[model samples]
Target: MSNPGEIAAVIRAVLEALPVDALRAANTAAGESAERIAAATEGTGHDAPREALAHIAEGIERTGEALAGLGEIRERLNAYLAVLVPGVEAMVARPIAGPAGKRPITPPNRRHHLNSVGRKSQVREENTVILPGTDVRGDLDAIRRGEAAWLPDRDRCLVNGRLYGVEVPGTVYPDEGPGLVKLNRSEYKALKGLIEARGDMDSLPSALANNPAVTGADWQRAAEVYEHHKDYRSEDT
Candidate 1:
């Protein structure tokens, strides 16, 4: 047992030598920092959920941009079609007229098909000629005399193995077909009866109108018949 004054002095010296005050101040600062950290964490919440929301907003904006681009492209295509439609309609509105019963002339690219059919055989073998009607008897006699004339009114004629050409009743080229054949006596009589009934020699001929002569007739004899007939012969002849 020491004196009370001396004991108190020793205890004070021990407390000063130790770091107790420094430790207390450090603990108080640590508690304040922890509380600040807790408040900051509560205020902001989880970073992951906010990041997910930001990504969703960005994706929606990109999708909207893509849809707008598509709409612009569609508008451009519609404008192109609107300009093109009227020109196409105008072309369709106008059409070219061709011959009534004849084939459209062969195009250049497909003309090779005609080579096998039109063999360029003898004119007699390729009897593709169609002679003038009886109204033009003088023209027929001139052809028999070895003259080549372009007779527009009739199918072209083959005279002395030569083609006398025409346009309306087109001249058949050597490769086209065999020429006309002779009409039998009975066929000739029937043809004459048709012509007599119509009495319009310049109009469609008996063969073309409605007669057996249409298939194949002796156009040479047919011409002669029209020439001799007083009712059918031209006034000039």
Candidate 2:
């Protein structure tokens, strides 16, 4: 005899046990593609194409929402199944042991290094040329000074904390021209002093403005480190 409740439980268990990393990644890509197309077409005479792309982005968003909804449904089913069956979660989560008596053919690091396919697949430098315009250095300097951020926004990196013209030439885009990349030294003294004094992020604005070399990117990276090591401060208080 077959049971609908039992069938639902199996499905729920499978949903809970499976990873959604790839699905979430694909959805994020689709959304970004839509954003790029929209940004590229803004103020141009391409309303129809832009509208279509916007629709496609909406569809991708809906699909992601549906996947999240499915996860919620799985939770409900698991609750129902828990009442129907005992130790079901444990049974579903049981680990499968690797094959016994199988000795290593190569050391892990050596095997990874010797992966010929991986080596060939690595991205090789195609070309490099200087990206002119005093703006680029200015932006990086601002970022170093905590006055600018280079965080991701769709297909573009927000330049100098500018709210508009996000897709213009010389702005940070993944593709197209920007020519050669020059590494700029980050000034971390001001932010470093604040950290040494055990100051939180609340009072960083004035300190950052004073230090032109210590940029916004430096502040962001510092914030992440502080978050991870915050317990050290907590222990003192």
Among these predictions, the greatest TM-score belongs to 2
lDDT tens digits by residue: candidate 1, 91-184: 1111111121143222112111211112232222122222232212332333322222222333343222232333354322321212322345
What do the candidate models score in CA lDDT, each in turn?
0.35, 0.40
What TM-score would every model get versus the actual structure? 0.18, 0.32
Local distance difference test, candidate 2: 0.40
Name the lDDT value of residue 161 in candidate 1: 27
Candidate 1, run of 10 with poorest lDDT: 89-98
Q: Residues 60-83, candidate 2: write the lDDT tens digits.
A: 545545545545555676676676
Model 2 regions more than 4 Å off: 1-9, 16-23, 90-237
